[model samples]
Target: MSLVRVLVLEPSELDPVGPLGDWLRDAGAELEIVAPAEGPLPPLGDYDAVVCLGGEMSASDDAVHPWFADVRKLLAEAVSARKPVLGICLGAQLLALATGGQVRAGTRGPEVGPLLVAKRDVAAQDPLFADLPFTPDVMQFHSDEIHVLPPSAELLASSPRYPNQAFRVGACAYALQFHIETTPHVVARWCENSPESAAAARPGDVDDGRLRSVHEDIAETWKPFAERFVRLAARYAGSLPGDPPPPRSLPLV
Candidate 1:
C-alpha cells in the first residue's frame, strides 16, 4: 500500500510537529509541513490527512496572524471531505471556531504542566479514543480555551480545569487542547518563553526530571494513538472511489 499523505500545518516556530511527525512517519505516512507565512499552502486534495500543530497565538487573531483564517478554512474543508484531521492546542481552538464553536482567553488561567485528562463516557464509542486509558497523561501550555464545542461535536475527554480538552467533529476530525507532541527539551523551551504560564502548574511540574518522566508516560499512551490515526488515514487513502463508507466505530487494530 502507498504511504498515507499527511499535510502538517505548523503555525509557529516554537510548536513544530515535533514527536508527532516521527510517530506518523513511523506509522507509514509521508508528511508535508507547511508554514502559512512562508508561502502558499498546497491544495488539500493532494493529501489524505492533516495535522495542525500548536501555536503561541490565539486562534481568532486574524488581525495579527492572517493565516489563522486560512488554516481554519482548510480544517473545515478537510472535515467536510471526510478526511482525517488532528488539531492540537491553537489548532484545536481554530477547529472549534471554524465549526461554530467559541474560543476565548481561558477563564481559569493557563493550564500548564503534565496533567491527566479523563475520557468522557462517549469516548468508548470513538475510533481513536476507544482504547485509551480513562485518564491519559498530556502536556498543557495553552492560555486560551475552547469554551464551546462546535455544534454536534462529540466531547471525548476533559480535565477538572478544562471541559473541552478533546473533542471530535464529524467522524474523523479530532481536536486536542493539550500537547502530546512535546519533548522535555521542548517543554523547557516553552517554560523559558512563558514562565508565567509555567508558573501556573504545580511546583516541580516543569522540572527537567518531571518533564522527562511525564513525556515518557505520554509517549507510552499517545504513540499508539498517533499510530491508530495513521491507520485510519491509510484506510481512507486506500479505499476505492466507490467503496462503501466504513463504520464510525473503526477497529483499534
Candidate 2:
C-alpha cells in the first residue's frame, strides 16, 4: 500500500499531541503537524490529506494573526485539488471561511460539554460517521461557530446552540466543530490553565467533571472518525478529482 501523507495545523496548547499522534500512527497515516506561526507553513502540494486542528484563536482573527492568510490559502488549495481535508473547531471554521461559508462568534454562547447534537439526514448515512455514537456526547470548547454552509456543502451534524457541528465541503473534505481528536487528559491540561475555566465555576461554566465526561466520549469517538479520515487520505493520496457534490439537507429541529 502507498503511504498517506497528512498535514496537521496546530496553534494551541490543546491541539493533538502524543495521543493523537499515536492514534494516527496506528491508523497507518504518516502525519506532519505544522504549527503555522510558531514554525513555517509548509507547501500544501506535497500533502495527500490536510488536517487542521482546533486553536484558541478564531480563524477570522486576520487582524491579529497575519499567518491566517497562509492557512486560508492552504485550505482553499486543498479543496481545489479535491484532496481530503479535515477541520476541527477553529480549523472547521477556517474551512467554512475558506469556502465562502460565514463564521461568527457563537451568538448562542459557548458550548463547553457533552451536547445534544442533532444530525442531518446525510450525517446519519455518512460513511465517515457510520460508527459514530448517536446523539453521542462530543467534546465542545469553542466560543465561535459557522453561520452559513457554503454552496454544495453537506450539513452533517449540529446542536441546539450551533446549527452546524459537522459539514462536508466536497466528496473528501469535512469539517467538524467538536473535538473528536481530544482526550480527557488533554482537556484537563488546557482547562487547568485556561483562566476562564480555571478561576471558578461561573454560572453556566463547565466544571472539571463535566469536561472530563465529554472528553472521554470524544476519545472513544475518535477511533472511528480517525479510521474514516485515514481511509479518505489513502484514497486521495492515490487520486484527485472534483467529485460531484453530494445532496444535502438542513434538518431544522
Candidate 3:
C-alpha cells in the first residue's frame, strides 16, 4: 500500500512530533505539520489520517488558547467521518471532550516519567492494541486525565493511578492518555522545563541510560503499532460499508 498522508497538529511549541514523525515516515506515511496555537484549524479532509500531539495546556483552556475550540471541532469531524485518528496526552483529553467524555485534573497527582499500563480485557479485541504487552512501558507527562469516556467508548488500558488511560471511540478513532512519542532528548527537555515532570521523577529515573532504555522499549512496541495504524487508515478510507468481499479465482489446470 502507498503511504497515507496525515495531518499532524501541534498545539504548542514545547511539544513536537519527535519519534512519532520518524515512525510515521518509516511506516510510509507523510505528515503535514501545523501549529494552531493562536488561530483556527486548516481546511479539513485533505489528509488520510489525523494525529493530534500533546501539549502542556489543558483541554478546557480555550479561554486562554482559543485554538483548542477549533481542534475539538476537527476531532469531532474526523470521528464522525470514521477517519483514523490518534490523540496523545492533551490530545487524548481533547478527544474525550470532543466527544461526550470529560477531562479534569488528575486525582492522583502528576503521572510523570516512565510508567506501565495494563491492557484492559477489551484490548484483546482491538486491532491496534491486541498484540501489545499486558503491561506496556509508556512515557507519562500529563497532569490531567480523562474522567469519563464518551458513550460507547471502550476502555483499552489502565494503570493504578489512571483508570482512563487508553480508549477507543467509534470504530477507528483512539484516545491515549500516555506519551508514546517522546525521545530521550524530548524527555530531557520535559524534565528540565516542566515542574510536574521534574517533581515526579524519582532518583535515577531521569538518568540518560535509564530513559534511553525505556525509549528503546517504547520504539520496539509502538513503531509496529503505528505502521498498523497507517495500514488501517488506508484500508478503511476506501472500504464501503457492508460491502462483500470479492470472489477469488481458482487456479487453472
Candidate 4:
C-alpha cells in the first residue's frame, strides 16, 4: 500500500486539526501542517491530498491577510491537478473564489453553533456525502459565505439559511461551508471567543448543551468521511511511488 501524504494548511492560531487528524492517522496517512501566515507556502506539488482548515479571516481579504491570494492560487492548482482537496469554512470560501465563485459577508449573519444541513439530491452520488444521513449534524462558525459557487461546482448539501453549504469542484475536490473537524472543546473555545455567540446568548446561555451533545453526531457522521479522504490520498499516492517524499516536518517559515 502506498503511504498517503496530506498537507494541512492552518491559517490561524485557533484552527487546529481535532478529530479529523485522529481519523487520518488511524487510516495510516501522514499529515504535514503548514502555517502560511508565518511564511511562504511549500510547493503545491508535494502532497497527494490537501485539507485547508477554517479561520476567522475572510477569504477575499487579501490586503489584510495577504496569504489568502497564495492560498487561493494553491487551491486552484490542486483542482487543476485533480488532487483530492477538502476545504472547511474559510477554506471553502477560498476554493470557491479560486475557481470563479463569489464570496461575501454571510447574508444570514454569523452561524456559530451546531446545526443540521440537508444533503442535496446530488449528494446521493458523491463519494464523501453519499452515505451521510439526510440531515447531517455539522458545526458552523463563520460570518462569510460562498455567495455563488463556481459553474463547475456540484452542490452537495445545504440549509435554509445557507444554500451553498457543501460543493465539489473537479472530480476529487470538495468545499464545505460547515465544519466537520471541530470537537466539543474546539466548539467551546469558539463560543467563548465569538461575539456572535455572545449576542445569541440567553441568560442561561449554554445553548441547551447543544454544542456538547452534537459532537457525538459529528463523530458518527464525519469519521468515515475523513477516512475515505485519506484513502483517496493513498490512491493518489500510488501513482507517484518514485516521486519525492513529503516534507519530513511542516514548513514553519
Best by TM-score: 1
Candidate 3: tens digits of C-alpha lDDT, residues 1-253: 6668899999877889988889888888889999987566777678878999899888888889888878888888787777789999998998889888998888888888888999999899898999899999998888888999988899999998889999998778899899898888888888888865578767777889999999999999899889888877777655323422332322110
* Candidate 3 wrongly placed segments (more than 4 Å): 239-253
Model 4 per-residue lDDT tens digits across residues 171-192: 7789999998887777677777
For all candidates in order, the CA lDDT equals 0.89, 0.75, 0.84, 0.82
By the TM-score metric, which is better: model 1 or model 4?
1
Q: Tens-digit lDDT track for model 1 on 154-195?
A: 999999998999999977899999999998998899889998
Write out the backbone clash pairs for model 2. Answer: none
List, in order, the clash count of every candidate structure.
0, 0, 0, 0
Q: Between prediction 1 and prediction 3, which has the larger TM-score?
A: 1
TM-score of each: 0.94, 0.85, 0.92, 0.89
List the pairs of residues colliding in candidate 4. none
Model 2 lDDT tens row, 20-113: 5667777788889888888668887888888888888877889998888788888877887777888888899988888888998878667765
lDDT rank order: 1, 3, 4, 2
> How far is 248's C-alpha from truth in model 1 (Å)?
14
